[model samples]
Structures are given as C-alpha cells and as structure tokens.
Target: MALMITDECINCDVCEPECPNGAISQGDEIYQIDPGKCTECVGHFDEPQCQQVCPVDCIPHDPGHQETREQLMEKFIRLTASK
Candidate 1:
C-alpha cells in the first residue's frame, strides 16, 4: 500500500527530501504524498524513507489505495521509466 500524510503533520519539511520516489510534497499547510508516485520505496530503498524520517509519525498506510507488492513494483518501474 502507498503511504499518506495525515493532518498531524507539523510541516517541518523533514519528510520531503527523504522520499526516494519524490512522492512527498509540501501542501498548502501540511505535506502530502502522491499515491501515483509512491511505492513505499520498493525499488529504491529497503523501507519507506519518508516514514522513517518523519518526526510526528504522520505517515500511514493508505488503506483506500491498497495494492499488492507486485502492483507496487510495477508502479515503481513505470514511474522511474523515462519518457
């Protein structure tokens, strides 16, 4: 599953650079994770870098956008593929 940023985020700008996929971005107030680009760091890292660096633990599994490991991997490949 992809991860999402909750409202509890302090917007401290800690999680932005940690994302290997560049999925995390600063929103109007809180930071947001783009589900289409998020792959939980499947191809780039051993684990989700954003979640690991988050101070408030605001990043959580997105149940609404649930996907299997295979699907996530495919998504990762497609995202990284150059146009």
Candidate 2:
C-alpha cells in the first residue's frame, strides 16, 4: 500500500529526500505522498523509508491506495523503466 502523511506531520523536512521513488513532496499544509509513485520502498528497501525517517510517526498506510507486494514491485519496475 502507498503511505500517507497525516496532519500530525511536523514538516521537519527529513522524509522527502529519503524517499527513493521521489514520492514525497511538500503539500499546502504538510508533506504529501503521491500514491501513484509510492511503492512502500519495495524495490529500494525492506521498509518504507519515509515512515522510518518521520520523527512524528505521521506517515501511515493509505487505505485508499491499497496494494500488494507484487503490485508494488511491478510499479517499481515500471517507474524505474521510465527513468
């Protein structure tokens, strides 16, 4: 599943650069995760980098963008291929 930045985010600016897929970005009020780009760091790491680095523990799985590991891997492959 894709992760989402909740309102609890502190905007400390730590998680953005840590995302290998570049799925995170500054939103109007807080950091936001692009569901289309997020793959839970499946191809880059065993854990979600954003969730690991967020000091406030604000990033959480997005129920709206639920995906399995296989789907995430496929998305990762597609993303890398376009690059």
By TM-score, the best candidate is: 2
- Model 2: how far residue 79 lies from native, Å: 0.2
lDDT of 2 by residue, 1-83 (tens): 89999999999999999999999999999999999999999999999988888898999899999999999999999999988
Choose the strongest candidate by lDDT: 2
Could you report the Cα RMSD, in angstroms, for every candidate shown?
A: 1.1, 0.5
Over 4 Å off, model 1? none
At residue 11, candidate 2 shows an lDDT of 94
* Local accuracy of candidate 1 as per-residue lDDT tens digits, 1-83: 99999999998898999887889988888999999999999988888999899889999999888989899999999988973
Give me candidate 2's TM-score against the actual structure: 0.98
- The number of clashing residue pairs in each candidate reads 0, 0
Score residue 68 of candidate 1 by CA lDDT: 90
Question: Candidate 2's C-alpha lDDT?
Answer: 0.95
